[model samples]
Target chain A: MAFEIHLDNFTGPLDLLLHLIKTNEMDIYDIQMVEITEQYLTVVEQMKQLDLEIAGEFLLMAATLIHIKSRMLLPVSDEPVEEEDEDPRAELVRRLLEYQRYKQAAEALEALPQLERDVFVSRFVPTEIADSADETVSLGVFQLAEAYYRILSEVPAEVFHEVIREPLSVAQYVQLVVRQLADGQRHSFRRLVAAWPSRAELVVTFLAMLELVKMRLVEIDQVADYGDIWLKLRVAQGELAAVDLAEDGFGYG
Target chain B: MADLKRLAEAFIFAAEAPLSFERLCLLLERSRPEVRPLMQELLTEYSAGQRGFYLAEVAGGYQFRTDPDCGIWLRKLSKERPLRFSQAALETLAIIAYRQPMTRAEVEYLRGVDSGGVMKTLLEKNLLKIIGKKDVPGRPLMYGTSRQFLELFGLRSLEDLPTLKEVSALDPELAEAVPLEPESDN
Candidate 1:
């Protein structure tokens, strides 16, 4: 009770209790209830005085200790103890034992050769390519969804008014995105979505961009999180043929 | 034997990930009994050599890894982030690893704290996985250590884990818990 206790020294109440028992060098099977309970309460009180955010489980353990202490104080009959009548400290001792087992196991685990610290695996490093080769920027789907949500919020409230007579297809949006990117021009996704008059049109255009990327006709690039997504025309041989064919006679109303 | 050792070393070195004995055997067109000793010979050869790398059996497989003595230099050169685990996370993970098919409530009971946040972090890191649901009253989800756990800790399998008794010998409180005979009562 006289010693200082840092909250960080122990993971939780059980860890603190185990530390107390070990430091005292008391036999766990025959833990001195009155002494242990008093020490336990003092520690909890000290934690409270320090304004530490003691978790509810700690208080619950304190209450259980107090309950066990009070139970031990009750007068016993002159008759010999029955088999069913167990020691008050049995459950607490069992829990402490179980927790101690795991604490040691954790220490053993920590002693193992951890990856990247005690061991290093081989990492495949791609050979440097010439600047002439195309570089594809990959965006995580989560980031793509976040950018799409931002665009969705920017759509004017009035766009929801008219029930669209015809829902624009993904193919139509794909063609629309291709036309916008004609002549090897790069366009920000926001700018492309802004050009559409209705939310339906914006959504379709977004889908079209996804399709283009999937088909290798276009690539989506972002420099950082929440950054502007850039759409570039993929100039691969197969995509070149498709772009040329689309340019020949494709027109959108 | 030297030729086989060289072949095994090349296969393990060129592998993108840890290669299991079965995989190596299949690749070499040799049985387990034949390939295992050759791989072991390769393991000893690498460790005894002045090479910067060593062969390790981890994640139920064998792989070539940089020598731990060169870890600092390799980390500096590669700029690979170190995997960090808080004390609480380690405790929770240890319990799960030793006692798989355990529910969240069981973990909380053992730790005597809310392990939900730590469990979530472990799940996100792929260190812990929800194997199934416990057939209890509410049917809470059961969690187990992922294969990534073994890889991270350099353990070949659950059998490779240090026994509770062995660990307990290091701590007085833990040593006291080990019963001379198994208890039949729950």
Candidate 2:
């Protein structure tokens, strides 16, 4: 409580608590809730006085400590402590321990001979452009999902009172995607889903595209981070017909 | 064997990325068993600490890197950007690295802080990647450490990180209980 804590010293409430415990030389398992809570509140008060905006998590932990402190002040229940009546501090302690593990792990990571930071690798610049053939990397499922969500957001929200529309199947979308790439040119994933009229149809088309990628019929590539994802046919044009578009027992319903 | 060792050393030196054992085998047209000793020879020779650079095993592959002691001299030659991580970013990374394929909500819960900005920064830095979508109702994207993460940490693999006790073991009842719905996604 006597020591001044800089606002920038702690990342969060738990981080502050750990520092307090260490500075106070208190056992983590046997934390004196009353004393620790007072110190924590003092720090929080100091943070408040300085006009440093306290995150909700810090306030939440403050409230938790006060609540636990009050519980610690209550009269001892003679009835007996059982599993159902575990210590209030148990949960907090568990969380603190968990956070401590990760914090230590993070420190261990920092201490490693990190590339670019601790060790330097020779920059191997290939003078010939041909030596560095592929500038693009394969796109991940989440990247595609992010693209789909962006496209979905642009589509008008599904009207509650829906009109009867023809059912769209993944099978049909599969053929559509195949035909789009039949020319053996790179097709934009966004353009493929951009035309779908309904969310349901778009989802089906998206699933179809995913299926194609899974089957190795199509490959998704992004030239740069946050760039447009392009889908190219993996098989030759003549071999496209030999590929099957059979629905593998999944219902769109 | 001598020619193979020379080729392996040259290839690793010239390669932009860390050259994996499998790739090295393919390049040398040798079986894994045959290539094992070739890589070992290079690893041993450079590991004596006499050379300016050492063959480092990182990100599950080998790359020629200047020794840490040489970093002072190397800094003068080129001014490559040094990687820096805020405590929050490192904590977030540690949580994800330990509990991978995790949703953002889980990460936030563990850190007890809103992690959207940190997660975004990690993703932008290519330290974290979206592996897939969680199957739960909201279909939140699941995140995992990327190859660059391992490379940056000089980790041979995720298993090489310091060992941690299983989280679920901290509370038996918590482990058995159904996962509560993730806090409404930010």
Candidate 3:
């Protein structure tokens, strides 16, 4: 496009009208027909010359403007074509006014305080596992688990395809991890993830860790300023229950 | 059968994004106390076997997702549609996505142009959000990329962004037209 139009305030004819009003400081009800029409035409001409992909909204505004300009030029225009009829610019102004209000409202709404919304701290939490081994590092199981789950929410709705297959389970590795933890009270999360053979094993291992976290049967901790997260068998009351990997579904990947 | 496990599975399977325990609870009309444990137990049983897919939480929700190793294959599968966005939108979005909690003024200041309408349009498309008010004289609305931006862009985090050179190479002309500053890649 010759005129780098980035789908700005004029996604629709309505938004363009609002922008003209706000930027040019013209009152909606009393739009200076000659000047307003020229500015609107400038945008349309720009779009046309640049071969910008104009949305229908912009076209609709152009047609409305031409009609208003023609009406403004009609003989005895002040004779009042229809006393009860809408002013030629009324519909456009109405759209402009409403859009302006909401545009401001949207800005205002954003001005209010937000809760739980994240502003990226711009600090990277160095992956502890990466410290020991730095290669084609796939995302952590938890991160992948998350990325997989929201498959469609961020993607367009039309892209959604139904899945009829059953979910794969990591029962074997889950059992193995349980066993390893049974003998020892603690183990490195890095070691566990690294031990997995395939992507499936890695997922299963993470799932086991998640299950333990949920059941409160174990606690995975990354001490402040510490690197790797450690998984320790959960303690009950005042006593740490001796881990029993053989009884639970824990095994190697 | 409406069994709790099946319900959870269906929710996970049918979801377009992760379904957190709270979301599952809200969707199922079950108490969190009951559903949380059910999720745990089901998660435990599901993990006790080998499978390509696993249940995990991300974006503050939970859903069934394929294993990480499958990302390459998954990317291939998703590449079919080959999502497209206008260059100006992407440049404007890149600035907002990574360097957010920022205002329209700041965005324009960095990009050196009028983003008034571009910001508005992005907000309309739900690709960006008005996160909060900046502590300035006007308290302009701060902007950030939305979750929908993530889904469409296929970015797991801001860090998922390609190296500046690589991303710039995708459309060198546009990159030259609107070269982004590397300051905010922090």
Candidate 4:
């Protein structure tokens, strides 16, 4: 039977294989190896023609399918086959069954009332909780890491003739960031990094941002993926100097 | 009876998050058996009243949300971006939810692709979490769904999940592919 195979329609090779088997209405336990292998190869060829990036795993499955087909072609022994020497398709069948189970489960999940879809919980927060948390916006550490890498790439590679140690600590950077945000306005991460002249200084600045976040002194926000990161001071103006002094003393000691 | 339903509605409406039955009881100073029926009564009343909002039980709690039919209008007003999940991520999440404490290698074997990137995204989103390491040869990390997942999916609990048979019945082709009885240990 002719089946129009679309690589995008299937999650991967096994999904495609399962589709083919189901479309053909062949008993999974009693698969027609020769026919299935031919169909599988055809799908792979189509994938190549379409210039889709066929992962190594797909090719490996193709080889396995061919091997199974070849084994099935060999003459059967007159003596009864041992239980350990099970059907050549046993391993593949087991995997397909396992995958199918999860596939079904996923369908069930999709059918449920998803948040922000079928149902939405109240976005409202009790005033007390909101005040205590101070509505601080934050980005994941991963985003900070990305920002660090971008800044690092901008710095020219250094070939040092002698080891130069700079007395830079995370606390100092925290103070620097707080001073920069003294106006209580938001600052972009790139802007913060741009103020530093050297790669070492940039590193210290990034470390300080991390420290500030840990101390709940600054809030970081990223609106979207790979988007600009914004940082703002969390503490009030009156407490800023006190925080700076405390952090500085802590850093030096 | 009318007074109690209105009170339940007001409580659910003002709450910042889904209000659990226990919390509702505590706030109302009522028993579990007393609060549940009141909530149900409110749910039925809203459905019958054909209001713009309805009472929904999500994340093991009751909350007042806009009716699905009014979703477009709500989106226009809020302008909030809806969450989107890729097909691969959903499938992987499903496997993790059902067969968890599963290893990455096991998920990859079932998926027939390198799921490293997808898994990382799920972890970053706080949908899936590393529960612990499995006691195997390499001691691969085991993953399971996070509480965030339950909340995001609006599931009260894992028990709220539909059976495989029920889900597969939605599609004839899928029903044929998935056996009525799953023999795998997972």
Which has the greatest TM-score?
A: 2
lDDT of each: 0.78, 0.80, 0.58, 0.76
lDDT of 4 at A4: 51
Which candidate do you rate higher for lDDT, 2 or 4? 2
lDDT-superior candidate, 1 or 4: 1
TM-score of chain B of each: 0.80, 0.83, 0.56, 0.74
Candidate of highest DockQ: 1
**TM agreement with the true structure for every prediction:** 0.65, 0.66, 0.31, 0.62
Steric collisions counted per model: 0, 0, 29, 1
lDDT by residue for model 2 (A102-172), tens: 87777777777777766888775866853665645546665566779999999999879878866777888
Interface RMSD of 2: 10.5
lDDT per residue, candidate 2, B70-129, as tens digits? 766666776656778888999999999989989999998888788999999998778899
Docking class of 2: incorrect
Model 2 regions lying over 4 Å from their true place: A1-3, A81-83, A127-253, B165-186
Q: Order the candidates by DockQ, highest first — what do you get?
A: 1, 4, 2, 3
Native-to-model Cα distance after best TM-score fit, residue B180 in candidate 2, in Å: 38
Query: Native-vs-model 3 lDDT?
Result: 0.58
DockQ of each: 0.23, 0.21, 0.01, 0.21
Question: For model 3, what is the alpha-carbon lDDT of residue B38?
Answer: 84
Residue ranges of candidate 1 with Cα displaced over 4 Å? A80-83, A125-253, B1-8, B25-40, B48-50, B72-74, B78-81, B166-186
Question: Given the true complex, what DockQ would model 4 score?
Answer: 0.21
Q: Can you write out model 1's per-residue Cα lDDT over B1-186, one digit (the tens) per residue?
A: 458768878878767567789888888888889987887678778772368877888887888877777867777875657877788999999999999978999999999989999998888777887777888799898888887899899888998998875322226545354222232353
CAPRI band for model 4: incorrect
Q: In angstroms, give how far residue A47 of model 2 lies from its true place.
A: 1.7
